[model samples]
Target: MTPMIPMIPTSTTIPLLDAMLADPARAQAPLGDGPARARTGVAVASFIDGLRCFDAGPTAMIARVEALAPEAQLFAWEGVGLAAEARGQIDVALAAAPTFAPLLLVGAGWADALRGRKIGAPRCAHVDRWSVLDGQGFCLGLLDRRAALLEFAPEPTVALAIDQGIGRSLYFVHGGTASAIERAIMDVPASRRGALWSGVGLASVITNGLNDTARADLRERGGADLQLGEHLAALLLARISTPPHEPPTGWAATVLDGSEPPIAVLRRGLDRG
Candidate 1:
């Protein structure tokens, strides 16, 4: 069984939010087209407001901490309110404090937020793109800074300081126990330390899939261990091939089934090394 990790009290939420909003560079990292990006920002802002209203105790703590940071901008996306309009459009909520960068994204509805857009999982795909772009992403800094990601899907929630000058990303997967997600985030890999940010993103996607039982059977049968490197490799492999509708029987099956050839190749390389 995976070991338990400490839970981040809701109190830290607001301060983290403030940090993300403070940095325009991080906040405006071109996600998609101009209108789409605007909408994304709104969705994030709205989520933050919702969090404040929904959980007062944590919001108070976050507010107090945020008072110490630099100023930031907050926005929210309410969406079109049509059932059919909800599919791929993301609903984002945001908040900003005076200490760190502005908190760009508080809550995200992956399905409704980016309606009809196949963005995959933002955290996972974002990290992969970063890796492909520069052979690294800001994940290493996030790990060093002790940041994490939190999700509560059907609506995925991410809490972290993006523009505090300390680059880090944190995320939680849908249906996962908060404690487990925290533990996984803190257990960043040692070898590919530079890829910590991307790893967190990848981990979220895998865990999200697993939580939904979409990939549970495969994980169990594949004999797959939830190590960061292995998970990243597996996700890359799955993305390139026909990801199993559900988890495969075992690691061998997952790798051999052509669902994850990249993982298979990585395993071979590791064996040789």
Candidate 2:
């Protein structure tokens, strides 16, 4: 009888193995991002879904994620982001991505999560970096309210990512209502409001978190940003495209206006008023 051993980073014969010797954020850079925006978008859509496993051990969580189709595996990775961040050891997840979760990376929204710094990000995930930031934003909202409101991303796009993440967080943290979200958003600076609104739009549609009437409430509160949130969810839905057609078969077609972006569309309106 024989047993196989896990390959260490020192393995000279394998590139991915060699990659492990590099920094965690880029350990999978050798694999390229594999259509990064799509990857990040799917990660955001399912990130919350994976959070259910926050208390599970990594091996148990990885098993569940492994059973999913390849494109769907981000469910586990994004969960790793949340669990690691909550413990204040954010980079630990990427430091040793399991072999299956190839191409691990982090970005602006991840390190200094509440602060939204562009730390530890590799160029491979320029746009993908935004989604992790969104994930981190969720962490901030759920875990640290003071930091969530006090810190803000300065760059327009970076601000958009951080704000959107926060917006998504509000849906989970505050009672998942439009009115509550509106009141909570008041805490965000006015300049960041659009992206934050877009994020609520994202959370509602992506997770099917809100009902029709409540969604309408969000629409009024979210406005163009709400429509953008739905559109971004639709756009990423196309990227993930799981069976049962997530959010109903025609839902994506109804919301998608046009032009999926290089980054997750922090701005999309789905032709609604």
Candidate 3:
């Protein structure tokens, strides 16, 4: 049996994704198809908010902590925002601190632009996820399923545990100091990235909240040109009624056990502060 993995402390950043999804009012707001659209919006909003918080806090911390711990595992992604903000954060972080090394997991398309760019390129792994066009006139990978956490400096040391799961994905850069990470975050385009990020999360919620017919109709109507938000909302409603089949894997078994109330109960008790 696989040993139980501890849940990392959540980062204390914005709860954009959670807020949007949790609110039925927002979920029920009319975006296009009236009530249905509103409901979809709510879910999308929650997802986006969650993504933002993850990126700014948990995602960033995972890298730093993994560098120090070397046994930690991270599962996360970027659901919204422009490629520029994502890349900019990494670049600034690397530039501000030379002592720390940063490792990045990028999509196959972004390998070229992010390779050997000086900012934070300790190591770059490719994962199949999503991509975006940056303001710099470059296509950047937005999500990945695999990554490495490495240290900065001449020798470029890897300082963390690297693991991957079939459906579970990991993202972010590691092996960098906290200060460098902070500087890099500062460089992210706040307004534009924030909006885009929120939109993406909202889209996810919407997708997960749709009914079968609505989802099918939306898909048939839009195809690739479909509005992300609308498409997601319908899809979500459909999925809620009928969840997708889970792939059989050891990791899936582990996650199921880890999510049991017994473990969650113990965790809550420990957090009674």
Best by TM-score: 2
Worst 10 residues of 2 by lDDT: 27-36
In model 2, the Cα lDDT at residue 248 comes to 28
Q: Alpha-carbon error at 80 in model 2, in Å?
A: 4.6
lDDT of each: 0.28, 0.50, 0.26
Off by over 4 Å in 3: 1-30, 51-56, 59-87, 90-130, 133-206, 219-273
Cα misplacement distance, residue 182 of candidate 1 (Å): 25
lDDT of 1 by residue, 100-195 (tens): 111212122222122222222233222112221111112222222333222211111121112111111322221223333334444544322223
Candidate 3 per-residue C-alpha lDDT over 164-237 given as tens digits, one digit per residue, 9 for 90 to 100: 11001101121112222223323433322222222232232323434566445534432332233333223323
> What RMSD, rounded to one decimal, does every model reach?
19.0, 11.9, 19.4
Candidate 2 lDDT at 63 equals 63
Q: Assess every candidate by TM-score.
A: 0.21, 0.55, 0.25
